[model samples]
Target: MLLVDCSNCRRALELPPGAHSIRCAICHAVTRIADSRSLQPPPPQGFYSSTHQHQPYYPPPPPPFTAPSPYNHAPRGPPPAVHGRKRAVICGISYRNSRHELKGCINDAKCMKYLLVNKFNFPESAILMLNEEEADPYRHPIKSNIRMALYWLVQGCQPGDSLVFHYSGHGSQKRNYTGDEIDGYDETLCPLDFQTQGMIIDDEINETIVRPLPRGVKLHAIIDACHSGTVLDLPFLCRMDRTGRYVWEDHRPRSGVWKGTSGGEVISFSGCDDNQTSADTDALSRITSTGAMTYSFIQAIERGQATTYGAMLNAMRSTIRNTDDDLGGGGGIVTSLLTMLLTGGSGGGLRQEPQLTANEPFDVYAKPFSI
Candidate 1:
C-alpha cells in the first residue's frame, strides 16, 4: 500500500496497489495519482518531456513566525535601515512542448522588464528574469527556482526600497483546508514543473515576500494569470463600480492566518478575479501575442493614463472591454467551447476584469500610483 495525503483535506490515507485515483473520505475530493514508473529525470539537454503527471499531496511546512498579537495582528517592528534600491523578479512560464503550452507568457515577461528599465529607471542588473529562454539552469521558471527568486527579491530589504514582482503564466485553485480563503479555495501559480512538483500556494507567497517587508518599503506585484486576484493574499481588496466609487473589502483571514505585510505597503494588480480566467491572445497587441493584463498595463502606463490607481485600473479594464467588443462580444460560442475544452469544463467564456488588492485601504483615485 502507498500512503499519501488527501489533496483537499491533507488527511493521510492508504492507497491500494496500482490505484490511479482516490476519493478522500474526509473531503470527498478525488485526487489523481501519477504513474511511479514515469518519474524519471529530465533529458540530458534539459528539455522537459510532454508527459504530465500529478504528484501526491504533501502539506508544506508552516511559515515561520514570531509570537503573534492576539488575532494575528501585525507587530510593530524594529525597522531596518533605509536602503533605497529598486529590484525585481520577473517570471514567465510557458510550459513549453506540453499540451498546456502558452504562446505569449515569455513576451509578457520581456515587455514588463523593458517597461521597468525604461520607464521606471530600474537598474537592469537589479532585475532577475526566469523563463524557458534563460540559459542558466538556475534561472528556469521551475518551482524551486521561482521560490528562490522570491526570496532573493526581499532578502535584506530595508526602508525606502522599491520592489516589483511580475509573473505571467497559468494560475489555478485548490480546496482550502485552512479556512483562510473567503471562497474556500487557495490560489496557486503553476511553475514549469508543476505537474510533478506541485503548485506554489498563496499562503507560501504571502509568508515569503509579504511578511518580511519593512515599514518604508513598497512592493508592486503584477500577475497575469487565471484566478490571480489576491494571489498574494493581501489583507484588502479594492472593489469599484462604473461611477468610479470604490470600497476596500476586508479580506483578512477569519482563521487568523495574518496575510498582511510587516507594516510595509503592498499592492497587487491581477489579470482577473479569483473566479475568472485571464486571456492570452493577439487581439490586444497587433504586433505580438501577449497576456491581456500585461499588455493593457503597459499600454496604460505608456499612454500616460495611469497617473493614479483608479485611472490605471480603469484604463486596463477599458482596453480589454474594447477589445472584447471588437472581437464580437467575448468571442461568442467558439471561445466558450475552447475554454471548456482547455480547462476540463471548469471554466467559462473569455471575459475578464482586472483586479487590485492591497494591504490597506486608501483613496485609489487620489493616491499617486508608483512602482
Candidate 2:
C-alpha cells in the first residue's frame, strides 16, 4: 500500500499497490499516483547524486489561482458580540502618479475616518482603511486588497450591527452581460490596479457586503464617485424633484437576480445619477480640493444639517447647487479654466445631483438619518 494525500483536503489515503488513482472518502477528492519508478526515494545526498545532473531540477508548481467569486464569502469568523457593534471600511483610491489621480481621495478617506471615530463612536480598531498612503501592502487600495477589506468589514456580523462602506474614487460603467441592470450597464469602482485586474462591479459589491446581511443589521454606503447612483444595486431608488416631492422607483432586476439584503436594512448615498459624472473640485472648499459629494455629505453632518434623511439630501444638493451657481457666475475665467483642467472638461458646466437608494422605501422626511 502507498500513502498519498488528498488534493483537496490534504488527508492521507491508502492506495492499493497497482492502483493509479485513489479517492478520498472524507473529502471525495481524487488523487492520481505517479509511476512506481518515479515515486522511489530520491538518491542519497552525496557526490553520487551529482551524476544525475543531466535531469534538471523542477520545483513544484505554485498553487492554482482562483478568480474572486461574488458568492465566495470569507471564512466565517467567531460570531460578533451580542450587543450592537460598529465597523467601517473606508477606501480611497488616488491613482497617484497616474493621469487618473485625484487630489482629494486620500483626504476624503482621512476625513471619513475622523467622522466615524469622533462623531459616530466607531472604534478605530474596527475600521479598515485602504488608500494609497497605507504602508501595509494588504491595506493598499488594489483590487484584491479592497475585496479583502470589504469581506473583513462584514464578516461575522450579527443583529444590531452597524456597518459603513465609504469610497471616494473614480467610478466607471461597463456593459452588463448578466441582464441584472435596468440601464443595461453595470457601475464599477476602480481600484489602483483596475487597469489590469479589472473594476469591482456592482453585482460583486452587493453580494460581498449587501446580500449576506442578517436581520436587524444596518449598512450605510457613501459612494463619492461618478455614475454611482445605483452603485449598491439596491432594489429601490428615491427620486426627488426640486419641489421636494419624491417617489420610490422600483429597480428590481428583470432577470430575477436578488439585489437586496437578506433581512438587514441598507441605505446608499451616491454622488450622481447613472448618466451624470461626479466632480473632484476645489470649488467646494477654499482650503483644499475634495470630492463634491463627499464634502457636502460631511459638511451637512458636521453642521448638524442631517436631522432627517430628506434634510440631509436637500442640504447636500443645495451645497453642490450653490457651488455650481457660483462657478457659473462670479467664479470667473480662471476658476472655470482650473475646473476644466482638473476635471478634464470643455469648460462648459458642472452638474451633479446626489442620489439615494435603499433596500426598502419609506418616508424620507419622517425617517431620522443615522449611521
Candidate 3:
C-alpha cells in the first residue's frame, strides 16, 4: 500500500498504486488520486489537462504562505531588505497566427518597459524582454527562453534586491497534480510554442521562483493575462471592493485560519480572478496597445503621487471602471472591472476585479509602490 496524504482533509491514507481515487476514512471526503508517488487529490473537475488551452480574447479559466508547507515543508525566513538594484523580465506573446492572437500583448511589454524605466527607475541594462516580434531567437517568448528568463530574474538575488517578472499574454488552468492548489487547478502561462513546449504550470513557477528566494529578497510579479490571479501561488491575497475596502485572503496550502508568512517578500499583481479573462485593448487611442492591467497600473501611478497599496488598488479599479465607460458601456459593477477601467476609465459595466497576493501580512498604506 502506498501511504499518501489526502488532498482535502490532510490525513494520511494507504492506497493501491493503481487506484485512481479513494474515500478518506477519516474525513470521508472523496479525493482523486493525484499521482503514484503520493495519494494527492486529483484536479477539480472540468480541466482538460495539466495545462490551459488557448481561445480568443473572450473568456478564460483559472498561493502561498510559508506558515507551513501543506505539501510538507517548514516555514520560510524573514522578509528581505528594501535596498538593492532592480532586475526585471518582461514577456509579451501575441500568438500571431494562432486563434489566440491578441491586439495589445506586444505593446503591453513595451509599455511596461517604458513605465519601469521612466516611472520606476529600472535601468535598461538590468531588464530583459521576451516579445514575439523580437528578431533574436534568444529574446523570443518561447517556453525555453521564458524558463531561462525566469532563472535569470532570480539568479544572484540578495536581500533587499528587487526582481520583477511580468507576462502579458494568454493564461490557462491545468489539473492540479501536486495538490498544491486548493481550487484543484494549476494556473499556467502559455509560451509561444506552448503547443509543443508545454505550458508552465504554477508548481514549476513556485518551485523555480518562490522556493529559491532567500529571506530579504523581493520579487514583484506583474501578470497581465487571462485567469492570472494566484499565478504565483503566494500565501495571501488582497481584495478590494468598489468602495476601496480591503480584505486579505490567506492562500497558504496549509489548512489554517491565519498562519505565519513566508520569509521572502514576494508580491503579485494579477489582471483578474482565476475564472475571469484579462483584456488586451487600445483604449488609449493610438498611444499604443496594452493589457488592461498594465495600463491601469501605469495610469494609477501616474494619476497622482505614490500612495498606499489600498489606495493604489482603488485607483486602479476606478481607472478600469472609467475606461470601460469611455469605451462603451456596462460590466464595471461586476468582477470584470480591470478591462473596463484601464480601457478608457469610463463608468459602465462590471468586470472581474484585480488581485494582489503576497506572502506575509503588510500595511496596505505603509509604503508607496516603488521598485
Candidate 4:
C-alpha cells in the first residue's frame, strides 16, 4: 500500500498501488493518482521517466531554527551581511498561438507573482517575473522557463528555502513524452509559435522542474491547466456576459484518460484536465486577474495551512470545489470538490467546526471558496 495524497488538493489516503481512487468523505471529491516515484531522482524537464538518473532524492535536511530576526523572518541575525540571496522565478506562457492562450498564461503568471510576494512574503527583489515578451524566467534559452526554474532548483535551492513555479497558458499531454504513459500522452500550454512537430510534455514538468527540487525547501507549484480536477482553482476574474457582473470560474475540467501520478517534495495544485480548458477573463478589470486555485491557496497559507504541505493543498482543493455560484453546470465541479474535501486531511489549522476525517467520517457541503 502506498501513502497517497492528492497533488492538487491536500487529501490523504493509504492507496493500494493499483487502486485508482479514494474519495474524500467530507467534500465527496474524487482524485486520481497516476505516476508514482515521480520525484525519486532529479530530472531535467517535465514529469517524465526516472529523470533522477540514479541520483536518489534526499528529503531536504532540516535547518536549525534559532531566534527569529527582529527585522526579517530569518532564523538568526541577518545572514553574514550577504550569505546568499533567496530568489523566486515566475513565468507565464501566454501569447502563444491564440488570444485565449495569451490571456490565460499572463493571468496565471500574474497571480503567482502575487502569491510569492504577497502571500509567501518573498520580497519583490527576490522574484523574477517573466511574462510573454520578457527574455527568460529561468535564464535558459532552449528550455521553457519552467525548465530553467528547475535548473536553478537542482543547483541552487537549499532545504529551508522556498521555491515556487507557476504556469498559465495551454497544456496538452503526450506531445513530448519520455515514453511513460500507457495511454497516449497529454499536451498543454505552449508558445503561440510552439512547433507542432515538437511540443513540451508533462515529462518535462516532472523531470526537470518538479523532480529536481532540492530537499528541505518547501515548494508550492500551482498549475492552472485543463484536466486539473484536484488542482487548486485560481479565480479567473471576468464580467458575466449577460449580467455584466464580476464572476469567477472556480472550476475547470477534472478528467482522466491517461495515467496520472504524483511524487517529489513539492505540492502541486493543478487547474483542470487534459481535455479541459482553464477559464480566461478579459484584462478590462484593469486589476490583475487571479486563478481561483491560487487565491484559495494563498488564503489557506495565511490561515496557517503553511504548517504542512498536505494541509495547505487540501485547503485549496476544498475551497475551490465548494464555491457557490448562480451559474449552471456543476456535474464536474461537485465530484471533484467532494473528493478534495473528504480526502484532504486536516488543514493544520483547526477552525471551530472541523468538517471530516478518518476518525470523524462525517459529510458536509464544503464551505465556499471565498477569500
TM-score-best of 2 and 4: 2
Displacement of the residue 206 alpha carbon in candidate 1, Å: 0.4
Give lDDT tens digits, candidate 3, residues 174-214: 98765557788988999999998799987677766777777
User: How many Å off is the CA of 255 in candidate 1?
Assistant: 1.6
Regions more than 4 Å wrong, model 2: 1-70, 73-84, 241-243, 282-287, 324-349
lDDT: which is higher, 3 or 4?
Answer: 3
What is the descending TM-score order?
Answer: 2, 1, 3, 4
lDDT of 4 by residue, 24-57 (tens): 3212345566632112223344444377756554
Scanning candidate 3 in windows of ten residues, the lowest lDDT window is 328-337
RMSD of 4: 18.8
Please tell me which model should have the higher TM-score, number 2 or number 3.
2
Instruction: Give residue 229's lDDT in candidate 3 (0 to 100).
Output: 93
* Model 2 Cα lDDT, one tens digit per residue, 1-371: 45455566443345666888876442346778852111233334442435566665443443332332335544222323332399999998888788887767777788788888888999987888888788765578988668766766776688888999999999999999878888899999999999998999888899889888878999999999999999988999999768768779999998887888879999999999999888775344322556778777887887788999989998888777765433422321112212322332123334888999999999998899998
The candidate, 1 or 4, that scores higher on lDDT is 1
RMSD for each of the candidates: 13.7, 12.3, 14.5, 18.8
Question: Candidate 1, residues 1-371: lDDT per residue as tens digits?
Answer: 55444565443344566777766432356767652212222235534335533433333444344334222222112222222399999999888788887767888888889888888999987888999898776688987678767766776687888999999999999999888899999999999999988999898889878987779989999999999998999999999857768789999999787788888999999999999988875343322556778877887887788899999999878777755333322331112212211221112334889999998899998999888
Clashing pairs in 2: none
Residue 47's C-alpha lDDT in candidate 4?
41
How many clashes in each structure?
Answer: 0, 0, 36, 71
For model 4, the stretches where C-alpha displacement exceeds 4 angstroms are 1-86, 96-99, 102-104, 133-146, 175-179, 195-198, 228-264, 283-288, 302-314, 322-371
